[model samples]
Target: MKLIFALITGLVFGTGIAISGMMDPAKVLNFFDLAGTWDPSLAFVMGGALVITFFGYRLAWKRDAPLFGGCFQVPTGTDIDMKLVGGSALFGIGWGIAGFCPGAAIPALGTGRWEVALFLVAVVAGFYVRRLLSPAGSAKAAR
Candidate 1:
């Protein structure tokens, strides 16, 4: 049941990304090109997602436990460090350059775009690079 739910949820999310023009690098790049032919549609898409997430979180919080867990598996780290900032900057740069973060990229690859393969490879490389560099990443050994 959990696997089914996860697959269904992922399908819905990927569908949303594709339908919203978020899967297209050109659309995202156009949004960034504010001085030229800027597409403001991405802003609306983000706003809609934010609204949905806000409400979803509120609803989730009202429950004592989630469907798959006793409590929310929230991130414990709240520190602002150079590592965090630098990693975020890199992610932002990659997203701007490719317009396909990990989630949407998978479905894009399923649609047979060769570009997504490169994007996925880069994403994996970035993950390994971070694991190699980050001090907090010693948890990998424990896992």
Candidate 2:
């Protein structure tokens, strides 16, 4: 049942990405290019998503548990530490250079692009590298 919901959710998300032209690296790059010919379409998509998420979280939290889950797995972290700052900076650098964030890269896979595949491989490698470097119990606790 959880798997079914996951699949459905992924499908909806991928469809939204595709429909929003987010699957195209050019479109995403254009959004980041403030000095050049900038595109604002992605901003509209992000704004719509933000509005939906704001209202959705409000309604979801009202429930004792999620529809298909035991409880909401919300992040407890609130402090802006070195780890958070470093990770954010690294993510921003990668996104700006490649014009493909993790979410965007995943849906771009459907396009059968080799670049997306390489990006995903690098992403997976980064995850493993992080796990290897993280303190034994800290990794589990972080998750």
Candidate 3:
């Protein structure tokens, strides 16, 4: 049942991306192109998402435990240090350059887009680079 729900959720998400013209590389690239033919439409989509997520997080935290789980599995890292900032900048740079984010890229891959393969290659390269450079091992090192 959970798997079925997950599949349904993914389908809905992909459909939304398609309907929003987010699946098109041109549309996404246009949004990032400040000097060229710029599209500011994605701002409304991003704003709506941010507003919804803000309230969703607040509501979720009001519950002592998640309804689907005995306890919530949350991250304990509270410090917004240089590493976090740098990583976020790197992610944003990649997104701005490629016009493809991880979420939309998967659905794009399903459509057999070559750009998705290119994005995945970059993602894998980043993973290996992080592994080689980071002092910490995997994310579970603390655990």
lDDT of 3: 0.79
Hey, what RMSD does candidate 2 come out at?
2.0
> Which candidate, 1 or 2, has the higher lDDT?
2
Model 1 agreement with the true structure over 1-143: per-residue lDDT tens digits: 88899999988988998898888888988988899989998998899999999999999988899888768766677779986787679878888877777877888887897888988998888777767776586464311
Residues 43-139 of candidate 3: C-alpha lDDT, one tens digit per residue? 8777876898799988998999865557877678888888779888988988888888877787888888787898888888877788778747646
C-alpha local distance difference test of each model: 0.82, 0.86, 0.79
* Clashing residue pairs, backbone N/CA/C < 3 A, model 1: none
lDDT of 1 at 121: 95
The superposed Cα distance between candidate 3 and the true structure at residue 109, in angstroms, equals 1.3
Expressed as tens digits, the lDDT of each residue in 8-119 for candidate 2 is 9999999999899787779888998999979989999899899999999999899999998688998787999888899789878888888888888898899898999999
Candidate 2 has a TM-score of 0.89
Worst-scoring 10-residue span by lDDT in model 3: 134-143
Candidate with the larger lDDT of 2 and 3: 2
Ranking the candidates on TM-score from highest down gives 2, 1, 3
What count of clashes does model 2 give?
Answer: 0
Over 4 Å off, model 2: 135-143
User: Worst ten-residue run, lDDT, model 1?
Assistant: 134-143
